[model samples]
Target: MNNVKSLNKWANAHTYLPVDLLRMALGVFLFMKGVYFFSNIQYLVDLLTPIDKIDRIGAGMFLIHYIAPAHLIGGILIFFGLLTRWAIISQLPILICAIIINFMGQMHHQNLLLAILTLAVCIFFLIYGSGKNSADYFFKMQK
Candidate 1:
């Protein structure tokens, strides 16, 4: 089908070396962060407490329960360059919410910085996709 060809073409699109490296680095960082969250779930919940207060009841709870897993999965997919664009798309909302929540009240500079960086990288991936060096390209080649 033409749609399949179009998809393959998109997936095989060339990317600058620097951009690919940046994407890989961001994926690694996010994957590590997800692992850290799993190990320190209570700590993550504690950090979200302030955001819940700023927003509504159970908002922080919802983010931790739902978004955390998505973050972890998205990180894995992005890291492997499997469905990278969709993975980034899924993470965009979480990153935006993180920025907003972390930016409010007595801000932690480090958290804000991390959130901003993640958001920037997510945006980049959303626009540019995985690139020629990715598993996406390999899969497309097989098709």
Candidate 2:
């Protein structure tokens, strides 16, 4: 009886806010990228122009895999509050490079906005974390 009560207490306490907020924010960014991909493939192609010299076909294929799917998966993980820290860590490099690309390409204000927002949120997740509301907690629970 006491064990049941303790378990219930743990479950009740599982509900928290920070993780939800991060999840929502991450979802928005991911959704935005998918929208952007479908709407402005040409713009992305232009932004990715630098890689063209390496191998045009390969660059296109790489972008299709790297840029499009990553956002989708990242968003999903965040939405489900699973592996969120790892998700953020995985996403940081792409986003940071995007910011660099935009700055170099002189893209514009909006181009920088998502990058900045993603970087800020990822940094927060890296620090304070999502507490017990993530797969990160599951791993820690084992230890």
Candidate 3:
């Protein structure tokens, strides 16, 4: 059908290299940050404790235990442009929470700025998707 062809065309559209580079950089940063948390998990737990009390959903332990691994896997997915949109969506909550916590808590201004920049990058990827250099592009070419 014509609709299917149109969809395929859109999927296979070329993207800017800079966008892909940005995606990879953000992914690497998130992956590294997640890895860092494992070495200093108590810090994450401390950050989430007040949020847990406010949300009352018992998310303190959950966020500490699960968010880092999710960030690691999601970052890899974004880096490779494998299921890129889903990966970005999955990570958005954690990033948003970080932004909120940074603002609400007494963290340094630099941390808040970094969270904002990271969130902006996530928004960009969400809107534009993985660029030409991605695995998605390679796979699309094969189709």
Candidate 4:
């Protein structure tokens, strides 16, 4: 699509080291969150219990299954800057739901802040794409 091309061009022209570091940090943070969630399944279940109450379709169960794996894979893709936008796209819904759950679920201050921060970083990368130091740029150059 024209929009994707334009976005790529814009991102390519604006690559910076700070942005790249931020991207890597975001990736590591996400990966760690995934590991934490996977290891502490009961913690996640307890957090989502309230949302499950609102929806009788057992969507929370599905989310419990989906979130950890998505974060793990998406985090790796993002760290390597491979298919950057798509990786971010996969994470968008999860991040949005995280923010919402923080409000409607356990209401933990630290969790809410972290979710907000991660969501903000994700939105930035969704728009910025991977930078010149990324696998995306390397592959683009190969082509």
**Best first by lDDT, ranked:** 4, 3, 1, 2
**Model 2 per-residue lDDT tens digits across residues 20-136:** 566667766776776777677787677766554535456575765677667778777766657766777778878888888786666768868867987887776555554555565
lDDT of 1 at 77: 86
User: Which pairs clash in the backbone of model 2?
Assistant: none
The alpha-carbon lDDT assigned to residue 44 of candidate 3 equals 78
lDDT of 3 at 22: 85
Computed on alpha carbons, the lDDT of every model, listed in order, comes to 0.76, 0.68, 0.79, 0.86
Candidate 1 lDDT over residue span 1-143, tens digit each: 67645654664565677777787887888778888888889977767666546346656666776676777888888877889878888888877877776766468789888889889888777766787878887886798
- Scored by TM-score, the top model is 4
| Model 1 poorest ten-residue lDDT run | 49-58
Model 2 reaches what TM-score against the true structure?
A: 0.69
The stretch of ten residues in a row with the least summed lDDT in candidate 4 is 49-58
What does candidate 4's lDDT look like per residue over 68-125, in tens digits? 9888988898898988889888898988887888887668898788888888899989
What TM-score fits each model? Answer: 0.81, 0.69, 0.84, 0.92
Select the stronger candidate by lDDT from 1 and 3: 3
The best candidate by lDDT is 4
